[model samples]
Target chain A: MNPIRWLVGRFPTLALARRNLSRATLRSALAVTAVVIGVVAIGAIGMGGEAFKQDQLEAYEGFGGTATVEPASYIEEGNLTNTELSDGDVDRIRQAAGSATVLSVHEPTDALVQTQSGTLLFRAQINGLANPGEFYETRNGTIPDNWRQTVVIGSRIADQNDLEPGDRLRVNVSDEFDRNFEIAAVLRPQGFSAPLGADRTVFVPTSQFESGGYEQVIVRVDTRTGSIDGASQAIEQEFNAREQVVRVEQVQEQREQFTEFFSTVNQFLIGVGAISLLVAAVTIANTMLMSAIERESEIGVLRAYGYPKRAVVSLLVAESTILGVVGAVVGAPIAVGIGMAVNQLLLGDPLAFTAVGIQYVGLGVAFGVVTALVAGLYPAWKAANKRPVEALD
Target chain B: MAPAPGDDGVTADVTGGTVPTDEIIRGTDVVKEYETGGQTVRALKGVDFGIAPADFVAVVGPSGSGKSTLLNLLGLLDVATSGDVRLRGEDVSTFTDREQTRKRKETIGFVFQSFYLIPTLTALENVEMPRMLDRTPTQTRERATQLLERVGLGDRLDHYPDELSGGQKQRVAIARSLINDPDILLADEPTGNLDRDTGDRILELFDELRTDENVAVVTVTHDDYVAEAADRVVTLIDGRVRETEDRRANFEEGPDT
Candidate 1:
């Protein structure tokens, strides 16, 4: 027979299962709670992981593009060094990464800034960029077109010194370079990323620090041409071929590392959740077995009424399935809510509902149902095998 | 089982005239035994009986006299240890378990002492269960409704078993039993839990069903009123039939005896 017709024939068993579950409200509720807890664990962890990954990827994207290339000696061990790269090196990187944009950065040095009164103020990193517009924008005035004695400070430095665009401050830029520079603009806040301290750094024209040379070059891989990893590899080879030591930090690779880390953590949490569901399965099995035993006479009556053994088994399975389905129905949304709550707490935003998160919810529901069905098999079989006369007794 | 003395041997005239007089159910030398702990106890030993269409027979016996065992075997709810139990002249022993279940569904009905109504379903749902296995919804519902009306429970169709009295629940069960219009109705101590008035009403209903529905009614009862109301009475003592009396003949001979 066709599947629809077969299922229609089993409607009575389904109805009977639902009715029996309703009859024992507390036991059914407990079984459903087990499924709820399991689904919640799976869904929250899955969705929360997605929100975290998206947050991290977006933060990395703040640096612009998929990968960044810098001289290998720019950082020594765990500290920034006074290493430099020529403009020719940046040009070669752009050539090797065909159709890519390479923005050159000069020395990133820390200097003590003094207010107009010469009162000692905060010491912050100073950055000189050939193309500063690629990384940041002004909150007030625009960056200076000329490369003389003007510096654009980040919001943190401006707020710390009560300085804004047009304000003048004397910087202790080494003994020979100490001078008063006009603040051309105050930059908008940028969250954490590469280059160590970009957010708090002051930006000056790259020409002002030509003697200092370029320390790093941010690579914007042309995804329209090919894979970012391939472009990064080619760029790194070009530098190595020139006998130049360089480090190519692919943002995509870092995002992948974040994804891999989240997946491992998610898997561990889902495993714990699965264990709870397993316990629930045992609970459901015990409940179904007891129900079958308690309803022995009722089963005998059904058997005497000419219901087949298969029908009896179907009835028991239907009971467990209903428990699972109902629990999932109640649990899925709560899991999403929990994910949102965690996202809001950790990332300052609600959970971003990703396609993968939806699939996890579906998996959770399927897991709950399969757990109950598998757990109920032995009990259903036992019930189906009982003799009518023996059951009636 | 002294050769079931009869002139026809195959047919019996029980109901007025419309019923076919052919024997619909027959059991020859039926024996049933059970192994309890380490000992075997025989529940039925060499019992012989036959029922025809529209026949109302009451099997009256003491507890442990195998009245229920005999009913179970005849209704195809249990297998006999030895001898043959036949439905429409075909031995049930030869049929597979599934076939026997099909036979039970198609040809036999049962009324249990406890009503056996699924408490979760309404009276109508309980009644409609028998035909719901294979019949269309409209046909099953109509038949169930008519049966409930016949049992004087048409208005109680939506009520659950817990909402009904014992007699009302039993009436629903009786309606459920007839949903498929079976040829034989096996009732085991059907009125065992009812009051005298309720029991009398149920017995009268059974009597009316015998003539009107033309179904053979076999009731295992301890109530003397049921035995008196039946057309035939078979008494059993210690797993053996002691007497089979034609109650109709005894009634016609007048109450003097």
Candidate 2:
């Protein structure tokens, strides 16, 4: 049997409802349009939020396998005690880090640099590692295998001063320590989660910082075989086990905090979308109520013909449900299109829809159907309960 | 007055004594009241009415004479306020709403003055409606087609009520009422909306239903032609039965007599 014929045979009220809705084509179209707008609002907002969160999450990628161990300030007697990490502390961190490369960083210093615009002064972070090749990548030149007097400039400072690899720059730490060094390379811009704000720093050999203990230690875990969390925990235990000596901050923790914050923001945006659906529900209620009132005499004829009240209610509800289903089904793909556009605009990948984004589309469809059902209830009940004689009159 | 025995062996004692076995519907001292703006108004005051198989009864009265109220009680569309309305020897008041709906669907059919054909549905679908209520549309499809053909609407079966003429709509309604094969067909002013020629055709169709289909038809009308064509006419005046006339005898005796 044909499915429509079979369905009509089984649920004759549905056939009646379909025909009744078709009788008022413009009104029905308007009601269905309301539902479509509601579904699109919810699904599109939810998908857009998901795409934004994913984009932010991608920025935190590649930084997870690194941790920065810095000296923690403590109160001793009546004074604040801020101490630097010593060579002994670096040795202990290397021991606990287990296959992780440890590079001690010097305290950042204020230096005057020679620029095309003349000598300018700014605070520059300095790192003096034996093998900087393991921790940094160069955009224009390579890191030398041997330690040298040559220095590498960070991308931000290099761009500001028109300096790159092979450029000769004069640095004045003080009147007593002024020297000219060749710029070996311009380092790549490590994103916002970079440990020591590496984008604006300069890197030199350890001979430049030969006077004091290290300011911080950077542990680059072998992400392919080692865990950053394990390395961070081990280094913290080694340095701060007996006293508040070092603070271990893992880049993975920052990523997790970013994810949590975006999740809350996505929920808030979805809540805002649900309000539009509530307004659509009110429009559906008004439409159904008006339909019921206009069909009073027709309903009376059905009741007098012995249609049960439940059947009358079913006919009206079926009409609203059809509107909801058509609206939701049509809205789902449009929402997906909107989601793809958002992803393409924000993340540069059109198909970067997350599972949660698709789930939100499904949620919008379900909410649309439920909203229409709830709105139709009172009208169906009121119409069904009218006495046949009164309705006929 | 008591109804005389028909050829089908059905009789009704409308004088309120013993219940007849073959009466399709009977209303005994049926009273109906309504509350309008804090005032109680009696619509029907103790009217006794009954119909047997193959009977054509016309209820005629002025406006507000309770003819429609009596028709409503007899059709099981409304319950009598203080009297008994019975269908096939069972009191309708004793039935639950579901049972009443089932009994009404199975035992009675209704035709309204406005024709009341669902404007959205075609003539055939309107005819199939009563069976559709029973979830038996497939089973009723052939029968519904035959009914439309019988009512001279086979070519117009696909036409909606709006596309149909007033007489055509009434014909579709008549076919719809017969879909359930009910014993009683209650029509409230079935010809009220038609012209004289169309009204006469509808009256002829009612006569054919009474004689050929053995269906009892009770029409409430103010039209004199409808009352004159019925086997019996019950006239109501001021919520009470003023008189009951047997017109079958006059038809049998010829017009000159």
TM-score of chain A of each: 0.62, 0.70
A85-194, model 1: which lDDT tens digit per residue?
A: 77777778888888776777765455566778887765567766765666667798887666466888787778887889888877665533677888888877654444
lDDT of candidate 2 over A1-393, digit per residue (tens): 699888989888777888888988998888888888889988999999888877666756756588889899787898867768888888999999999988887754555666544556365666666666777788988877786778887888888777878888776654225677888888877654566666777777767765557878888887999998899888878877898779998877877887788788888888888888888788888999999999998898888788899988888998888888888988889999999999998788999999999999999999999998888889999999998888998
Question: What DockQ does predicted model 2 obtain?
Answer: 0.55
Give per-residue CA lDDT, model 2, range B1-257, as digits (tens).
Answer: 22323434544354436556877777676778989999988888776666778788888889998888777787787898987777888889998878888888888889888888888788998999877867666679889999899889999989989999989999999999999888888998988878999898888888777777778888999889888887788888878777678542111111111
Q: Which ranges of candidate 1 are over 4 A from the true structure?
A: A1-12, A64-247, A339-352, B1-21, B246-257
Count steric clashes of candidate 1: 0
Top candidate, metric lDDT: 2
lDDT of 1 by residue, B1-257 (tens): 11122223334322222223367766666788999999999988777677776777788889998888888887888888987677887888888878888888888899988888988889998998766566376677788889899888989989999999988998899999998788889888878878988887787777677667777788998888777777778888888877768543211110111
TM-score of chain B of 1: 0.87
Poorly placed runs, candidate 2 (over 4 Å): A1-7, A70-218, A225-227, A346-348, B1-11, B14-16, B133-135, B246-257
**Backbone collision count in every prediction?**
0, 0
